[model samples]
Target: MLENSNNTVLSEVDTFTNHYPRSSIKRITRYTTLEELHSLANKPLLSIGWLIICQDTAIKNSYLKFLEGLDQSNLVLFRITSEQKCSELLSALKADKVQYRIINNYKLKEEKVIDYVCKNLSITKVDAKYLCTRSGYYLPEVVKNVQTLKVLPKITKPIIRKYTEDRRSIAVYDLVNYLIGIGGKTTYEDCMQLVYEYRYGFEHLLKTTLAQITVYIKIYNLILDGELTLANCKIKKKDLQDKEISNLHDFRLYKIVESFDKISYDYLILLQLKLQQISPKFYSGVFDFVALLKINAKPGVEARVSTKINTKISSKVKEDLKTSEKRLDEFNRKRYTMTTDDCQKAFEYLKEQRDK
Candidate 1:
């Protein structure tokens, strides 16, 4: 996705706005402190989704009856981890309503899941005990996904994938990193080149609209209003080619970091001009400045809530969500933006819980 070479010739732009590839240390350093980023994984650490599949008619019907037996306030949260779930699961039973709930990792324990599965699945205690001890430690969803593998395909290779999460936080951290790069007087070509190189990871972000790019725009408006200190940060190797940095994991990230606050404003004017020259694709969300930011802020793991008829959701979900807001006199449902599909799934989950 590199632009035709006519415009990206780094020399055409002044040194303030343009930058060449820097040491992996310098690039990774510009991101939030090093303890947070990662190698590629399809799941965004910030989401709480679920994966539920019951191939056995008895298990499926039992789980559905279980859903029909719940109380509304005891709703479950599912972080649907797989964006590509259609091909992976339920291809044979495509018409079956897919159920999900968002869950937090702090609350999901292996022992608890094993206990729940043992009591619910009517399987031999030995098999239940065996599954409870499976060794894949990537995410709790890995366990849930494993349950479906008898019918679903096991991943034999590493695949690049994307999904959406925590828009505001992502925007803030990413914008700061971008601002730091520009303030450092890095060339625009290098910045654009980085996004092009790691386009797969950012494919979803690039499709998000700018209005969704909230925190950064609010800060950008504030910068114009002369409120917060705007600073530039830098590091890149001018000679590295597209072919050289193809393997991102090799981008040695074990370097030091300076917090966003520490970067200086020495190159502000140059940086301002640099922002002016950025293409509209970034504005339209066709490109994401975040490819350079490198990691999701606020990492979260997915919890797969099985939505079969007899499957019972543990009371754990309500215990977390139903709390009195200290400022509010009464406990109120927390408002969250969810797609219609997610809302309907939630509505069904609530109906199951509430109708009984």
Candidate 2:
């Protein structure tokens, strides 16, 4: 009960509070689509707590769209993720005259990764520490691989061990596989999907890995044919800037040329050098990237291209990728009725070649 201005005591239900109490009627949740966001905006908020916004841009945009659609008198409560994101959210909220709180972005440190796995994954501290310690400083990949590991039991998977052994190699392999899977023609979103879903066995995850393997195959073939030589193909540029190259809308080519950032084919060159140190036959040449790791390869490209394979091997990889996706879809429909035969055939081939 609350006292009115006239000094009369009355229950909240006796007034407009009956429609919306002094509390949030809707619980806290993540809004997946624009529809859900609008549904909440239509409701009245009795408290300063309702929506929870995370790091995903797609979902965050929807939340901002919802808030902007409301009037200034409307009450909007939301928490935006901090740490290298939420600029769009902030701008949208500002436009709508909304207010929000900025909390830590939940960044992963070296120890934090280990702790999360140990606590949430039901694994021993020793195992979790071992996993994080080996994956090095690539925190995002470490988190994803750890989450993938958490999905299964504590036993080590080959892919998980490979990820721990070298995240850069796994990243390059996935990047190359992703590029090849699209037949050297795709958008940035597709590239992100391959990198983000590399661990969870996205049906087409290994297509570019195989394509990368095949690119090496083509390089080796060229070397044997005397058509290309690493000595002649070596790129010579002083202080190449990767940040500038990242804007180059060609996923197929720039993924190899852009060396200014963490995710680039320049890392693949480094990986190739490391592989050659272990075994000469791994690449048999001083460079990978089709022995064409130069940025000035005639500025070659056309945007939003189709699946055009430079090699005959891509068709086979594409077929295998489709089959792997089918298996994943089947598993989704019936979790117990899944088999590793198609998956093993697609991935194990790359794994065997990756190690050898």
Candidate 3:
């Protein structure tokens, strides 16, 4: 099938026909009306079926309206992102009503990029390394950079470095650790450097941060409830399996539990709040995400965490804390029956006890 790069229809079809006169191909785009789609789908096929490329600028629920009752079995729209295959789309495809199967994005490995560069450009491993570094190991970026230097009489690491802008990337885990105050003392500038070094979209980083925070919060709650005791740095295997915390490695969990007291609970709560606020503004183009992190990580925030605790606790509040912990544990065990709002309320109840 001919790849749909642009909107020019007649010329591309002509070129395809000239190459393979026996085969027939038709292109359907996002702009194609429902009526037009039906007309095209119903047309007499010289071949088995038509391969249509639907390129929608803004994917929405309304697009599904175009295919509700269509009976085009041979039409296939395969090159789509995972996000586009919503629940509604899945249901249609599952019932065999929809003919197309949307596919997830495929990422290229570093080895593939290195092999391509070495074979096509006749460059050494050293030169290929420079290209990979400069392009941040992104397939499209690397291809674009190499194409610019392919016409040159000779290619070298220095020449590639000089010609292409440096977008060398950092490890995602390293940056996440720095942002969450795991290993080292980090400044706002340090966090920003890591953020800028990431080549993928900010959405991936945001999702990763949310997931990591969830893990930390679960561990924190376990410590508060005396389930994972900090004094002994040990937990029962059955407890881990029950709470779904078994995915964490043994040594890593031990380190986190040991250092849990060192990391301020207040700061983590502040960071989680800031992350939730900025999530809606992620695509607004107005908010600075790094600035939110900077504000949350301001000096003296961690100082709010006190090592000293009140020895005397009222019986009522103590009972309430136990009740909240029980509810949270239950929610963790049977999450399908409990919403995130329920978990938040339990946390707030625990917070009130801590304050008392």
Candidate 4:
């Protein structure tokens, strides 16, 4: 009776083991020199196993290639076409025709895939796998070391603790003020630094690569939302200052009603009158020289000789006066006078000079 009990116990154990589904494993051998498939056939423990769960053949091929290049030990490639029956996969494994002993059971596939990963890769749970995949950054040996794997929990904590954290949302007022502050003056290097600082300070929960993309997307959206008016943006500080000064000068000039040509002519005439009034000593000296020349003329023919000498001197003076007038005209053409206030100040100074 004891021997009969032992046989029944053994049968029960066998039945339980057989009822457990087998893991589907696909062995992807990396080729060296694109020719030898078995040249580097060593396996490393992949902390996670991924079942290529995509239905698209192109996606499958691309994922297969991606996995084949990834660490070879953790990778298993399986294909499930719509036409292929599940029994065929079992038969292939039973006949030992599969390169790897893992078989894909469509009924409990998702759980089976997770189970196979945890079993073969020596990982504790499926959450680690999800974190790594969602990170979008390629980390080949993240699961190889236990210490590095701990980063996954910290990374996922933000999602669970979302309510406790003060989330940052881009406000329209903030966007407008930021644009007005830097706007066209912000260089590419400045933008890069700003993005880095923003990510490090406010977006510590997000992955670096994702944070960068998110920042860029926000900038693009701000532009699309008409928050930033770029048509008149000045990228340089000097350029902005120069434009402001130019606008002020134009405004001042615009307020003056008199035409510049008429103003210039009136200014020249006023300058000539001022010169004539202020230089009396110079005019007196010239008059004295002419009188001396007339007095020193021949005695008996004093009037006639003095007239001839005066006529000759007057002719020479006329020529000199013509040259001086030409020079004065050129000066007036090139030089500009100050505005009404400056002219009043000059008149006051000339009156003081005359009084002295």
Q: Which candidate is the best by TM-score?
A: 3
Candidate 2 Cα outliers beyond 4 Å, as residue runs = 1-85, 95-97, 104-107, 121-126, 133-288, 293-356
Ranking by TM-score: 3, 2, 1, 4
TM-score of each: 0.21, 0.32, 0.46, 0.14
RMSD of each: 30.1, 19.1, 15.8, 35.4
Writing each residue's lDDT as its tens digit, candidate 1 over 1-356 gives 11112222121122312232221111112222323322211222433211112212222333444433334422222222222222233332344554543222332455655555445454455554444443222234334434443342322212101111101112322343443432233333333333443345444433332322332343333333444332211122112233222111122211111221222222222223333433445333222232222211112101111122222223322332332122121111111222345334533654453233
Among residues 3 or more apart in sequence or in different chains, the pairs in candidate 4 whose N, CA or C atoms overlap within 3 Å are 23-102, 23-103, 24-102, 24-103, 25-102, 184-235
lDDT of each: 0.29, 0.41, 0.53, 0.31
- Rank the candidate models, highest lDDT first: 3, 2, 4, 1
Candidate 3 contains a number of clashing pairs equal to 0
Which scores better on TM-score, 2 or 3? 3
Candidate 4, position 159, lDDT: 40
Q: Which tens-of-lDDT digit does each residue in 1-356 have in candidate 4?
A: 00111122122223323433334223332221232222323332342332222222233333344435545334343334322223343444456433444332322223433343344443456544543333211222222322333344443423423312111223322222122121223332233223323433422312332332333333333333543223322222124333322222222223221111112222223333423333123223223211212222214212111121223434533443444565455435333332345334544654453233
Q: Write the per-residue lDDT of candidate 2 for residues 1-356, one digit (tens) a residue.
A: 11122211222222333444554443324545556555665545454433322324444554656555655544443333332135555666577776565533243345655666567665677767666665654565556666666667663545456545443333554455433222244333334333333544432333434445545443443434544333432231111243222222234333332211212222234334433433122222212222221111213322212233445544534543544444334323442232435334534555554464
Each candidate structure's count of clashing pairs: 42, 4, 0, 6
Off by over 4 Å in 3: 1-23, 42-46, 57-73, 84-88, 95-105, 115-122, 171-176, 183-192, 195-265, 269-356
Candidate closest to the true structure, highest lDDT:
3
lDDT of 3 by residue, 36-132 (tens): 6666446444655554544443333455455444455445443333332333356655775544443332444567668777766757898887788
Better of 1 and 4 by TM-score: 1
Q: What lDDT is reached at residue 100 by model 4?
A: 48
Report the candidate with higher lDDT, 2 versus 4.
2
